[model samples]
Target: MDIQLLTRKIPIGISQCALGEPVRYNGGHKHSKVCTQLLGRCFDYVPLCPEVAIGLGVPRQPIRLVKSSPAADAEVRVIGVEDKNLDVTEPLMEYADSVVPALEQVRGYIFMQNSPSCGLRGVRRYLPNDHGIDSEGVGIFAQRLREHFPHLPMEEVGRLNNSEIRENFLTRVFAYDAWFRYVEDGQDAPRAGRVIEFYSAYKYLLLAHHQQKTRELGQLVSNARALEPREFAHQVRGGIMEILAHPASRKDRTNALMHVQGHLKDYLDKEETAELTRLIEEYRLGLKPVSAVLTLLRHYLPRSPHQFIHSQLLLAAEPAEMGFCDFH
Candidate 1:
């Protein structure tokens, strides 16, 4: 596992305010140290302030999502809270549409929470009468972004405070970047053999997330002869993203770790095996983080030197980005 091979920085989309830019309506930044200090190290952020991008000034009037009707097709406007007559929905949506083309290259997105423009979920939406707020509405800009790139990994800086969600997002981002680079750098007609190898590398990782989904993805890859090169690649990407969307439970991860340990069992001595078992048990009991067990596994990775194990992203996935597990 050469660390240099995994050191490429993936391009990620982010709310400008989250990067500590003064783009908020109150003329202050929502400066997330997690995004700026930690993730910033592994990602090249493409920042966008929907409000500011739409020509809203600093210290600008706050906006809120307003539902015009109860119908599903009813128009929802991003209107000024102070002056209800000021409807900026068109401009906000327009800005979102305009920038989506550029966002195609972004592997992940980190949105500011509770923002009417950037919140990925749980954004407040008010009734036209201003009587109550609905917590189900997605931000206008975030909504468009999701519509454009549904498979791209997205999270609010707030939800990322949860270790599981944070880990999931980082894993998805790196996996997506690896897939993108492979396709972009490969030939016009990527061979089925190469796709099978890619799927093999991620097999254990996918198993940790969902065994059934992993099997199904393997079937898809195995049946690659039935589809064209581009189609097969798309299916593989979508399948990987879908599996990763589910959080990896402790039981699932322990199972995957045990499987990995089985591969190196012959190489490790009794004492080494006992020590590895202890660390795995610690992780199972929630006494230690996944990184602790992974650290030990990675130490033994070079000793055996199997191609399948060496190429496993599960072992080498974002070691530097794991520093985020310590922060909110």
Candidate 2:
């Protein structure tokens, strides 16, 4: 199936500021062309601003994560840096809790970086003395979002500047959407069978991400018959997310590419095999993108097609969604 034809717009969540909204504390927007011009073409962004949604108006005082107590389980509070007594942590958390239920339809989210309210990671936390900041804090709102939807693909827009990270995020977004659609479409199928089929379709894609985890997931799927329906689906989704969390190394990707090459080996002559091998080596060496070899492989797909190879999302999850080939 042409996955791009499956939908024109995939629902996604985004920080309002990242979408060029003037929702920042300083009444500014950290507009991302990647999100706005590139990804925006395919994503239906549900823009959110936790600070604003919590009744903190534009041009409000900046909030910082401050360690409030020295106790073992000390709570961090989002308080005004200028006026330490002005705490807004409770309100922000409450707002996140209230808004998350409405975001269930979103397949993925892009957070603004270094924001105390929206940064996905490395947001600075201030010590009570105000002498220094620790980089261990995650944005309060991002934390709650993760807790609510652990399997959803969420990344900070800053990190998407890296080609591999960008590619991985796009892959996960499309895969998550595809998985959701698969479950929705197969509502009447035996649960175990649906789980198996879903995993099967994503097998090669999983292999490209992580081989050991993919094998572990396959084992987990085999045991699905013994587990409850919801439990089985949860396990499968968790395993897939864990596998995709690690960026695919060149070695691992080469292994997967070679696996695909094996599928077309019988059809290619010696010269063709050498040329394909050279292209794969070039990709492994970073001289060429994986799309180059995949494009060649796809050109030959019609000559000798296999159901498994053709169904692999690794080949093309949503080529036209956002010009993903350019990311490679």
Cα lDDT tens digits for candidate 2, 1-328: 3334444588899999998889999999999998888777778899999999888899999988887654536788788978888888888888889987789899899999998889889888877888445777889999988999999999999887776787788878877887777764445543667667778777777888899989989988988878888888888988887887788787888888898889889889999999999999999999997779888888877766678777666666435433433322
The list of candidate 2 runs beyond 4 A from truth reads 1-4, 69-73, 185-190, 303-305, 317-328
RMSD of each: 3.2, 2.7
Clashes (backbone N, CA, C under 3 Å), per candidate, total 0, 0
For model 1, how does the per-residue alpha-carbon lDDT over 75-106 read when each residue is reduced to its tens digit? 77888888988888788888999998899889
Query: What are the models' TM-scores?
Result: 0.86, 0.90
TM-score of decoy 1: 0.86
Candidate 2 yields a Cα-based lDDT of 0.81
The candidate maximizing TM-score is 2
